[model samples]
Target: MHAIEKQKSPMQSLAESVLDAHTANFWLQKINPLWSVSQPLGKIIEIQSAATDTVSLKIKVNRHFLMGKAGQHHPVIVEIAGRRYERTYSLTQLDQYHVLLTVKRIAQGVVSQWLCNTAKVGDVLHFGQPYGDMTVTPEQQPALILLAAGSGITPMYSLLKALDYSNKISTQTITLMYWVKQHADAAFANYFESLAQQHANFKVHIFHTQEAPCDARLNKNHIDFIKDLSNSTVYACGPSGFVNTAEQLFTSAKNFKSEAFSLTPIISDEGGFINVTLTKSNKTIAIPKGQSILVGLEQQNIQPQHGCRMGICNKCSCNKVQGATKNLVNGVENTEPRNSLRICVNSAQTDLIIDI
Candidate 1:
């Protein structure tokens, strides 16, 4: 009788489990029902030269169904030498049913190196879902001040394409200040030159770090150029230092906006192991190689807050009570000298004492 009851109880529990999903995990799935999604590393169709070192990547998404917002960014996942890596890139255009991405392959970059060297037209890519807060609304009716450095010109390109090519928005003019190392480093020079040639409103200012024949240097003089310009709504994107410097430069009375694509540093043990202490539960856990602090905690079913999981939204920002982590993009070490860590990007190094 006991044996029979055990089997019957297991079956009963399975039946009850199905019914419980509606009540407990209803919000686990997508908010929109019709939005089918997949993350395939797309095929590289064309890679265009904008200026010098700046290159625009045009990729075709693997899709017979489902679509995405024009200016959203998607994660690019690649496997190299049996190691998996993921990085985010913004969509440049909706060239037919396939997707498009523009990327500048920095010499110090990992994924960028792969794309510049090995990525070809027929090669497949594993892509994450489109995400970003930088979409343009046609009804917003605000003059755009586009600030970009090097390859950060991508999002602005998407907005420009949407606003100009699609004729979706009514605008006065778009003032674009695209800073690069030299004229050759500007990725969309020809395209923007065409816009400047054709439109009375679209204007571009190129600031070169290196002495170039046809541009302005992005020094105090470059910042001074905007002093007389109208306070059109500002939108800036670039490297961490570049973005911060631009923000400080435009920090007068005029309102300037900016977004950063910088990643926090993550640390790990020299021995490829780490000790993670969840100060909340008063428990210490050991994390081995190839695991992030977030994954380490979540393996025990600890669900932490996350927005954009790609280090952008900063929902997972937490104060680190102790220890260290390395930056994934740039191999820089950061110490938790006092408080908070974005656990999503931070990995455990040595014995970490974290207050969740």
Candidate 2:
């Protein structure tokens, strides 16, 4: 058994030898523009407009691509003006070979606007491994409550479609409550409505927050929906405010989940400054108690590598050699040494030394 397990196939041995640094540099220079040694790459196969300011890019992934779960997100790398920027987006698998990335343009979102307006087919892009936990298997629950607002419907859309297409949603009650500013901003409305008409247990409620006569928003007053909280697994996504509101309302639900990527400024009630030392760079600065370390470093003209600007991406996570820090999201303080923390959403509470 040990001898059989230790044997390598001929193709595996060839691949291992070919991918080594000494041999790969020759082949890398030929095809490295669209490929990387450390990450997977994909090429855009098609681009379709989803809504007024949104577009979905269908990509064909390479062999290095790691398939993500139903509601996971991938960080994409794009170069603009000779500078590379990274942005994360939820993925919707179209098939084994293809996946869709839905991007909505924000007011000042550089990567989003470029992807929505300027990106085209056949463009090769780099992608980080996918990660997230807002997923559900068919056997997990008999009933589900999905709450989404604005662009938050991306992941919910993936989960619903995956279940329905696989014929795994029979007799399971799923209620999706989606809120958008206007009717024109709603994507996948026709597809979801068609699914609702065909499936007896699937329902969709779209709330137009900027409609002419009535603008409906989710609140504690959605009495009928709130009554079912005890028996179903509830998932909510959107801006910070929307997720926060849902969490408050469904505080006592059986199972509740939410995902938010909003980068709201950290407001601290505690007032003080802590000394922060970046050991690798040999730089020390004073960071305020209530502000994120990322913001503090930027103010001092020292920029650390980051993506999403939110905690979800984990791109700005660093090792802490010492000191106590507070997580701005949940206000949890940690004083453990040799710990990893997201610098974008954590504030220094005591003198700190970190590997940056």
Candidate 3:
């Protein structure tokens, strides 16, 4: 019996056991292919290619799907070549039955590349609870400014569609400044253009960095396009450099929110090697000084628990029993023993022992 069933009486258990679902564990999913229970699984019902290197998947969530506020992200898990990988994505709710996820193919990105190239209809994947705080709240219903570049436009797209669909703002005074490398790389261009045509107050400005070099980027000259910029709440997402540039330009906005892609540090080979003791695995490996501990472990054919692989998710966090490590995000070094650190973001600076 399942652990949760321990609270029931013998007679109650017997009475409920008449149904195969109550008596048997979740093995029914495999035993009977037609059964659909309240599991946290989603089936891919449709797939659409959105742009040059991007694909949108329409997933029909299970009965137990818990919807989240628009613009929030959910950690999705998919298996490929007998190895499971996890990544976080912002969901666009089509309705209670289905949601949309857009994946942009990154160079050598495991999950993104798989979804864009090989994933097909009828594929089922698991997802964790929705997370992220980039949503628009009722109190923030003022003039809005959304700045997005590359794949960072996803969360902002969710928020934009939710606001427009809910009719929460009658004036439609949302201004979106989207930056892309070229015209072909821009996703959802036609949808944005349609919104601009339907509403007089809704405006969109597209900056093509490659095709129209001189007219691209956000600077002092672009600030004139947004009316009442000081009173607007600005949300920006993109690469770290683009986000930092947006933050600097929108310093005077009423509220500023930003989320950037994980920072990729240039791992240098200036320092000598150090020993890394994996306590649980009862093994030790020599890792280069300037590389992430996770990458170092993987080189030795050891896999540790991880999700998002970016520091945003705490799944890769483990105890540093002794020695020093550095945070790649801020360049801050920690030397105190018996502390928790994210293996994905930190590189070893000295001999270390960790609980993995």
- lDDT values, one for every candidate: 0.62, 0.80, 0.79
Tens-digit lDDT string for candidate 3 (278-348): 89989989987777788889888888988765566678999999999987655679999989989988888
lDDT, candidate 2, residue 298? 85
Name the top lDDT candidate: 2
Q: Write candidate 2's Cα lDDT for 1-356 as tens digits.
A: 00112354464455567688545534553554433343467889899989879888999876567768777788889888889888888888887768889999998888998899888887877788888888986456678899998889999988887887678766688888999988889989998899899998888888888887666688987637644678788998887668767888887677888887664445757677789999999988887777789989988899899976658878899999999988765557899999998998888888999998
A best-first ranking of the candidates according to their lDDT comes to 2, 3, 1
Q: Between which residue pairs do clashes occur in model 2?
A: none
Q: Total clashing residue pairs per candidate?
A: 23, 0, 0
TM-score of each: 0.65, 0.82, 0.80
Q: Who wins the TM-score comparison?
A: 2
lDDT of 1 by residue, 47-115 (tens): 655545545566665442224465567667777777867777777656554556666777877777887
Q: Which ten residues in a row are the worst by lDDT in model 2?
A: 1-10
Off by over 4 Å in 1: 1-41, 47-54, 64-70, 139-141, 168-170, 212-231, 252-255, 263-310, 313-352
lDDT of 3 at 91: 83
**The CA-based lDDT of model 1 is what?**
0.62
